[model samples]
Target: MYRTWMRFLTPGPAHHRLGLVCLGVGLQHGALPTVGPRTLDHHVAVVISAGTGWYATPDGRRTPVTAPALLWLTPGVPHHYAPDPETGWDEAFVDFTGPATAPYTELGYIEPDRPVVPLTEAAAPRGVVARIARAARRDNPLLEVETAAAVHELLVTLRRARADLAPDGDPVLKALAHDACTPMTVADHAAKHGMTPAELRTAVRRGAGCSPKDYLLGIRLGRAKELLATTELPVAAVARRVGYDDPAYFSRLFTRRTGMPPVRFRAQQARAVPGGYGDRVPDPDDPPMIAGPRRP
Candidate 1:
């Protein structure tokens, strides 16, 4: 029987906290020998660079995975897994321990159960691999910090993908997501997607398990909050982008949805980012961006 490996990441003095793994293909060519049953002090992620691997969990559950698969391993989760030794896996991942970790968890990216989760098919994780390569090139303090920040990003990417893939999705849900930042009407979306409004509502209920309006509102609210907090755009502009017309009405809707006015929302978002981490992430308070100006 092939022996399972549990390769744990060793953080240098320059490294602290993580959510990403940025290593080169050099140390990643060989089969990971220390993956199965190894202790995870922080969190170790496996980002496949150029090989096939099998990710298995405790209790004998296993699945074959390949490059492009993002493996999220939380700290303290004792699990046995490894790569397909023949081809061997090339990847880098970290336990991602930091203040932002909890917020990531709250966003439903990392789960308490299984560690690995796949990201959206539309986006490429090549940047993560590049970041890892950059880190592997050196062990300097700056590199260490960069690796940690990169891991956090990898987590965020997966979180965004999770939002995209709704478990119990339906036609209306899909339609609403089709253009979250644009001025879209549910009736138009329903017609475009080939269903009557009522039928769309029913499908949404059965497939996504949420009301169409609620689902759309949730997505819009998330976008609105992001824009209000991250961008220098005026509140009126942010509201306009998110489907509201009048700024006063927008403020009311924003308050109702987020329980705080747009201005306050922006302040809270600023306070939430980790010190020195602001430059890394897009302004969380920035508005939802679209290709066009507000609808007529």
Candidate 2:
């Protein structure tokens, strides 16, 4: 019968306005029966990590509760829930509120009508609850800030987990998008993820409608463009920064892809801004070359 509960008397004005605040956090194991066929003024998220039970609504509808599931209690909602007495469950919960809550509801992350959301895995949600509980235990100066941040993190974690479970979601695309800036060949990237080059290419094409090499090249060029437009870094330096050791080869590739040399592209962009490039001199020897039409 291990149980711990911590409540905040006042979360303060700062927490109230941040649009999200944690009012309390608790963990219960082998606890006694039902908590209310009544209503609450704030929201509470109960994560059931083990055991079985039932959650009932005001209209006599009873929903079965299982382990590794999220039971949401929305504000002012009439609800009653309890674990099986014979085999009591383990549960962790956090009460939270703020103006930011409405957006989450509208985004389908939280639903008032749907009280139970079965999680494929409970580790992340359990970890977040533990974090909130730990932060609440410490009577630190940044208690409100820390708790609010943790709550936001919890919401983000839930949303991401849901996204990962979505039928159309492709994690391979996400990995590529995040790691595109790294200097690695397509084969190397595939090998790192325990995927063959052909498999990686197929996944990338299906997810992003582009080959792996093309996707990586696009990322490199995009970064190069930003650097060229904003900084005074030399072409050779920009080339190295974008994983290209050969300045001449990089310049040719940039020209082929963008239809303009790096220097010309920079000058064109600089001239677009008012009072920009007024005293700057363009490199004179960098001639623009127009390729002939390709034969089919």
Candidate 3:
């Protein structure tokens, strides 16, 4: 006989504004009946952890669903599926929806076009689902907020677990981020990697959901901010360290992006140190222990 446990939630409007909210969660196993040939109004991440199944898209093409796979059922999408009648499948699912989903989709964290996704492992995402299920208690006052926060974690975990992605991330994206502080044009960076500028653009867009130039600038400006706030370096020194040779140009760029000049931003964001600022972190609360003489 099949066994199933599930909880459906109705979070208030205020929780919806928190950017992501959980609608439901479930865990099931054994010979389950067929699901849908129907449509849903929200999204469901059905994680198949064991056994096998078959899924059909709106176009009527069916794909096999093996263990360690995910089925992304998005809003207004027609979906149909079922486990093998004899073996059945172990499945856990999380239903979620929010404005945050749009950006998550754009950033490649969610794939609507490809409904069935192979995962390298199902344990991590399943753990997140279990947490959501635990938080689904009827009388938990913090249930809505706790489960909603876990939804965000669940999405990120699923993205990282995709079978297509490398364990460390895309090689090209990793290399680009590694060299982000170098003073090189996108074309120069592309040439170094043996790619054309157009190809580099496509890779960055696919991996990061942004142009290559924007990606490098984000990294460079972030370093510039850190140097300005933590060190007593002059603006020009900060600029040079972050790859901009022309101080005037760096100032303008930084101000345009950060809405203030470097000095002003530093003034506002600088950390307060009990002792004078230095490379070593301040340990005001926990002083280093002194050694006592050893007993003879």
Clashing pairs in 3: none
Would you list the C-alpha lDDT of every candidate in the order shown? Answer: 0.61, 0.80, 0.91
lDDT per residue for candidate 2 within 1-296, as digits (tens), equals: 54656566368886799989998888888854688988989889888889889998898888898887888899988999988878888888889999989987865567687888777667788899898877776667788888899998887666545422543447886677667767678998899889999999887764455688988889889888877887787999989988888999999999999999999999987433333223234568865344778999
Q: Please provide, for model 3 over 3-63, each residue's C-alpha lDDT reduced to its tens digit, 9 standing for 90 to 100.
A: 9999999999999999999999999999899998999888899999999989998888989
lDDT of 1 at 18: 48
Q: Count the backbone clashes (under 3 Å) in each candidate.
A: 28, 0, 0
Best by lDDT: 3
TM-scores for candidates 1 onward, in order: 0.52, 0.58, 0.90
By lDDT, is 1 or 2 better? 2
- The clash number for model 3 is 0
- Candidate 1 error regions (>4 Å): 1-27, 116-126, 135-141, 156-174, 177-250, 255-296
lDDT (0-100) at residue 219 of candidate 2? 83
